[model samples]
Target: MSATTRPSWTWTIEPPDGWLVVPSTATEPADAVRAWESEVVEALLESFLPEGATGPDAPDPDADHVATVRGSLTQTVGSLVTFADEAATEGARAMAGVGLLDRGPVPVLVTVGMGDPDESDDVFMTVLGAKGGNPVSPPSIEYPDLPDGDGIKVSRVDIDEATGGAWVSVAAGRRTEFPDGVVDTALVWRSQDLVLVPTILDAIVDLLPAVKIIRSTV
Candidate 1:
């Protein structure tokens, strides 16, 4: 698509207290990877080595431990980079961030992306198909306060694996028409805490209003 016709939108959200939002421009894949890695490493270090744990001066983690943490995160870094790249290619803005759920410090991946107006349905369905499992209707999420369009459709899918047992994936998508064009937004996140689905969904609802469409000057 030409620059003037490209779909553009901005997403802003105030993550819950424990949650962290790793900002991303989606224009550079490498930058996204580095930002995510940096945020995660810091969060991990804080959780593992709480402030003032060792007397008045908290000891810093050794180089070896830091290296090990980065090494372990390498496996997932590529996926995040790919996600950011794809969003950029599709003329969409996206953020690939990590969330700290109630279940310990197990990092949860949260992605918010805005895509071409014409591909709104496809974007929503693609997220729902991420786990290839039956979609469970998410808690009633209505955005009556927002503009009119295909209201958001949210699905909760339970993914089971031989090694990982089971985890819950939530995907929500909405297509809203702006003065320029129809812009779609998708929010997806995975967590092992099934009981927190409602809370997560509520968060998603709170995030939708923050989406602002960028009108192309050309």
Candidate 2:
């Protein structure tokens, strides 16, 4: 399909202050991703640097800590990109957006997609099933009130031993059938601070209603 006539989806949420949202759609430009990475790197340094550190006393770009942070961020971004590509290969139209938390330098990822109902259900079930044998708690399901459609949300958290962190994953789908397929969305938050995960999940849930499916045509 030509760029002008291809249909695309987008979210319409107004993110809270201190949050930066970067578009990761299939059509998003490479330069935009690089710019986002730069912004995130700066935010992370500012958050981790000593309170009074500045100017000549700042950490060197070649320092181990700086490199570690950059490497981690690169891996996170790369994983999300690969995921979106895989979703497309499954006959789904998918796009992802990255949310950067300035103070904690935390990363939040949200993905929206549309595909056959059976295929989408199978994919969601696979994710839920993978959590079965782990020590993490079981996934929770809830019906959310949405403006335009009936909504169902499933959420779970997985503990990461290597980093002593946790990843909270939420998959919310609205029963809105389009000419092409059904609409679904997923949100993921990664953090080492267990105390903050609940607050972040609450914010994610509040924003779920703002997700809208948009179809574009020239």
Candidate 3:
């Protein structure tokens, strides 16, 4: 008898500049190929990183982290997709607010958080995309909160980890935590997320061609 494992990625997309590629590695190339979609899973966001940052996120590429990223992106995309699917969702108008550009559409940003990625003390995440106008606007959809998820009830100093030359280190962080570790009822659970959003938004703007957002008002 033989055992099997799941695939790495499931989607991919190419930008006008070139192909932002993502390959799922495994003994079974066929499984890897089937598991990942060339457009979505291999989203161009991987290519948009601070100069030194790397792709496919090695910080915590384990089963739990992988699932967290997938679930988070899925919820985000799904929520927007729903609005995209329906033209009448309330307050669903895509606003180009708080990004770098002059508020046109928006550079999609995706972030995933998990407890201590790569032995770090903080809950870690990887971001993709730049901002549209302010660069701090809320995501079209937020990631699902894990019930009784591991919470680090402490605050730490923010550090700069820019090793990739040419591009400055946009991805830096310290320990972040709400006053209370209980997330479900905590309003400020993801408060620190505010600081890390622009890098992600920038990545999205650079990589993705156009993000179709439904406008409820229009």
Best by lDDT: 2
Ranking of all predicted structures according to TM-score, beginning with the best and ending with the worst: 1, 2, 3
lDDT (tens digit, per residue) of candidate 2 on 1-218:
77658555654545555554544546468787667656666655555555534355666654666667667766665555555455445433333333434333444455565668666366644443323535387777777787766666666777777885676665555556666667666555544555665566566666565555667665
- With candidate 3 superimposed using the best TM-score fit, by how many Å does residue 114's alpha carbon deviate from the native? 48
Best by TM-score: 1
lDDT of 1 by residue, 57-92 (tens): 545655556556455555454445555456556554
Give a tens-digit lDDT track for model 3, residues 86-125. Answer: 3223211121112233221122222223232335332242
Q: What TM-score does candidate 1 reach?
A: 0.55
Please report, as a residue range, the 10-residue window in candidate 2 with the lowest summed lDDT.
93-102
Q: Relative to the unseen true structure, what is the Cα RMSD of model 2?
A: 6.8
Provide the overall lDDT of each model, using Cα atoms, as 2-decimal numbers: 0.52, 0.56, 0.29
Report lDDT (Cα) of residue 196, candidate 2: 61
TM-score of each: 0.55, 0.54, 0.22
Residue 48 displacement (Å), model 1: 4.7
Q: What would you estimate as the lDDT of candidate 3?
A: 0.29
